[model samples]
Target chain A: MNKCHITNEIRKFRFLQSEMTQQELAEKVGVTRQTIVAIENEKYSPTLELAFKIARIFNASLEDVFTYNA
Target chain B: MYRKEKMILASLLATIAVFAVYSLYVYQHYVVPKPEIIHDFSFWGKSFLFLALVMVAAQIIVHIVFAIINKIVTKKDIPVISDEMDKIIELKSLRVSHLIFAGGTFLAIGSQAFGIQQWIMFAKLFSSGFIVTILSDITRISLYRKGL
Candidate 1:
């Protein structure tokens, strides 16, 4: 299977936003900290709704948060 | 870790342990004896009954223990939330586990070509379902920990 590289700037964004912790982001986004870790490390791709929620938390656009590289 | 995931892991372990013990009993009593009437309905019925009883007991025990632990250790109401990634992980693990059932069924059919004993073939077919379940739970746990 061809792996499409879907990367995120969540860690970067989190740090820029007053060094927000993963737990805080997870709580604000209604997800678990492990999920935040997964997204930051590119282990799992967040759903569209979750991606939007996360971007909203970081006060950034969805495109600014996640990039899809084919 | 999510309490539900931990509960699943505990339940799966208990189930597998029960199944292992049951497998040993079946091997000794049914396979070793090689009864003349391979289609002994009573024998098979009792075996299934025992397995079902063990599974029910294991589930009850695991839930009680989990409840106690939840009350004692956490002292907080844990929310059970299923996220999108969790669903994806479940789908992936289930898809892989289904392969085990498919392969086991194929192998069971192939065993006929080898003139394998009917009782042994039946046992293989029966155990395959449980094995698939155990493997699926293990896969789900692993994916949760390591990422899907």
Candidate 2:
């Protein structure tokens, strides 16, 4: 539980997408901007539902948004 | 940002403040001797009365705040402090709090056994308990934010 489980490529995606703001993504995905910030910082693992929502927003698969590193 | 948490924090602060003020009143006016005419049994009675009042007042304030916050943020059912992630964080914090509490309590016992000042030992226990509780509360909030 203390270990950081999920890793992601969100930073690369944000850069690829015209340096998109976290709040814009969060608003599209129906979550608070802080949630997006937390995800980007790796300080939080998005819920399964939020994970899917993010992948959808990025037009990518779940593995594109998040993955279990260990 | 959630109303319920703000409400609860406010209640905790209010309760602690009210009791603290009442304690100040007792200590200043009644417990110690002063130059003027001494206070009477009423002060003793009042102290006891306010102690009870403090407890009751704290409980009532907590409930009232919860109710108001609930109504104000009616769309969100209950607070956001509880969830699978928060539950995990709470469990971790409780473990840390328990360890500190036990260790501090043991140190107090050891000091008394070695004949260090008893008042100091008591103070150690009191202070550690306060620290542990505050630490636990903070950990819970941090977990809520960080989703650990």
Candidate 3:
């Protein structure tokens, strides 16, 4: 939580995917939509399972969705 | 299940449980068809039977509702609970219950050591114990939800 990290591009991916609702993605990925929002805002970090889920949904590598600042 | 949906379902089940207990009380007291064995039954023993029934009914209802909802909502079966974050929060909540259990037992002993005249009766002791565990669990859950 302390180390710097760039937030997820989930919102952008979500928008690109014909405006997928948070709830829809949450259902697909098996997490609460609130968790999706938290990850987007960088307020919370997703578990490895969820991070992989997001990457899968976006059809991108983990690096595409997330990055470390330092 | 979605967390919010789980919460709503839990709240509904809790409300139903209270109603079920009240219904049983009324039936056992004034509204029942007739007492099976009127004079021979111990009142406390009858109450204990009703309490057990309520507990069993509540458990059944919770499972039934969760199963039904999950079936209706999705083809994929999601656990009522999921994942490590949830497990951690649940474990923390359970810890509060243990703390309250220990504290209440200690307090009861302390009162006896002070030479209090009356014993903590079974009903009072049971109610106190129940309240401590449940209150602690609920408060702890709320704290965890709020990021404590």
Candidate 4:
């Protein structure tokens, strides 16, 4: 089976958005900071709802925040 | 380490400690003094029941103590709410533990089928339960560390 890898530009967007900290973003998205770290490191894939929430936080579309690699 | 990971580690340590202490107490007080008690079904039943109750109480106390120590050392409140990732990790670890426990059960039953002593069968069951507990914690810790 082929593995699906999802990557994100959360760090870049976080930097663009007044240098927001992971903890701040986590609080805004209602997840723990460790979760944010995992997502940023590509160690985990967020659900669609969470992905949308994160993109919404950055005032961007889902595509702008995340990319899918198969 | 994340707070959840630390909690898992603490739980693992607590389990080992409790099992060690309980096993020693049981051995010195019961098994050594009256080896024939091994044949008593009621004795096995009571031991299992008491061990379970003690484990639950120990876990509760460990968590409380850990929370207090964590607050003092980190000066930050531990995350009480679990997020989506936490749920996924928990489910995955649970599945692994369940499979292991099932296998253990089969082995324990097989021991009885093979005409093993009744006490050996009970010991098998107890050992399997202990192994399952330890492996579950280990699975959780690994998932938290390496991610899903």
Candidate 5:
């Protein structure tokens, strides 16, 4: 089944932000490293609050970070 | 996976394994014939209660020991923080668990309607509950591993 319709550029953003590690992002966002991995891979979609947090960390807008395909 | 989630899954799997071995032993020794079990309901009930107690006690002790050892090694207290993704994963896993449990219960009731023995019904209910709980933990662990 197609579970997630949302995709993200977390990896690219993380790289642009001085190559932030998954653990670093996770710590900053108060989540686990695994969650970042999942979000980057598009296997899981983050809530609006978490999405905003990630975008804020990278100094990017929500649209620049994530895209919803239908 | 989150550290606390991993710990919980490990503990639950270990407890289920222990219970499986113990139940096998009990079945072999105490539940040889149908009539014998009927003659001593307390034996079955007491054994189940004791095993449940053991499982709970063992889980607590194991978690405590794990925490102490982790503290000693890391020298810092690890805090588990759950975010929105964690909560969503938890809810998804819970939905799956509830469906499995409800199906098992309906099956048990159906068996009773078909004139299945009371002992079998009880066993079905008990084992289904245990197995589904383990499956739920496994689901959570896998979701954390591969994503939800």
Candidate 6:
């Protein structure tokens, strides 16, 4: 099976936003910290809703938060 | 390790221990005494019913004890809500378990067709159930560790 190559700039955005921790982002996004870690590590892809929520938390557009490469 | 991983590991251990001890007790108390009782359908039915009840009770006790000990040692609460990733992993694990169980049932039926004893068929069914459960737990732990 082909692997997903979805990547995110969540770490960069979090850093720019007062060095927000993964736990804080998780709480805001209503997910577990482990989930945020999985997303940042490219181990799991969030759903559209979760991705939008995350981008909204950083006050950024969806494209700015996540990118997918075929 | 994550609390989820710890909980799974604890459950896996409890499964093995409970199954082993229960099997030993049943063997000593019932199978060794009359041996012919193994062929009794009613005996098998009662055994399966009791085993199911014991397993459910044991799992509840194990979870409660593990949770209390974990809280005292780590001072952290276990996550109460499961996220999407957790649900996906659970579904995948259950799929594997169900597939294995189906295969086990087929093999058990095949054995009966080959003129095997009825008792062996029941044993096969029981063993398959146990194996699927253990494999499911292992699959969950592996998915958590390696990512899905």
CA lDDT of every candidate: 0.81, 0.68, 0.62, 0.91, 0.80, 0.91
Candidate 6, position B80, lDDT: 89
Candidate 6 error regions (>4 Å)? none
Model 3 C-alpha lDDT per residue in residues B4-108, reported as the tens digit of each score: 446544745564566466646755774366544332325435654666576567757776776677678776454444644455556776777777777776776
State the lDDT of candidate 4 residue by residue for B1-148, as single tens digits.
8889999999999999999999999999999999999999999999999999999999999999999999999999888779999999889878988898888888888888788888888898899899989998998888777876
lDDT, candidate 5, B1-148, per-residue tens: 4565657676877778878887887777777655467346577578779888878887888788778877897685656677777787789878988998898889888898888876776677677778777887787777777676
List TM-score per model, in order.
Answer: 0.79, 0.55, 0.58, 0.97, 0.81, 0.95
Tell me how far the alpha carbon of residue B122 in candidate 2 is from the true structure, in angstroms, after superposition.
3.1
- Candidate 6 deviates by what RMSD? 1.3
Query: What's model 3's lDDT at A64?
Result: 87
Per-model TM-score of chain B: 0.77, 0.62, 0.57, 0.97, 0.78, 0.97
Worst 10 residues of 1 chain B by lDDT: B76-85
Tell me the lDDT of model 4 at B139: 89
Regions of model 3 farther than 4 Å from truth: A1-7, A32-34, A37-44, A60-70, B1-53, B62-81, B117-124, B140-148
lDDT of 2 at A53: 84
> Which CAPRI quality tier does the interface of model 3 achieve?
incorrect
Q: Give the share of true interchain contacts found in each model.
A: 0.40, 0.28, 0.00, 0.64, 0.64, 0.44
CAPRI docking class of candidate 2 = incorrect
Candidate that would win on lDDT:
4
- Residues B1-148, candidate 1: write the lDDT tens digits: 6665797798898888888888787768776888554578577678878888888988899888888888789895555576777788789778977899898888887898999866676677677878887888888877776665
Q: Quick one: best TM-score, which candidate? A: 4
Best by DockQ: 4
Per-model DockQ: 0.42, 0.21, 0.15, 0.60, 0.54, 0.57
Candidate 4, residue B90: the lDDT equals 86
lDDT by residue (tens digit), candidate 5, A16-54: 989999989999988877778889988888889999999
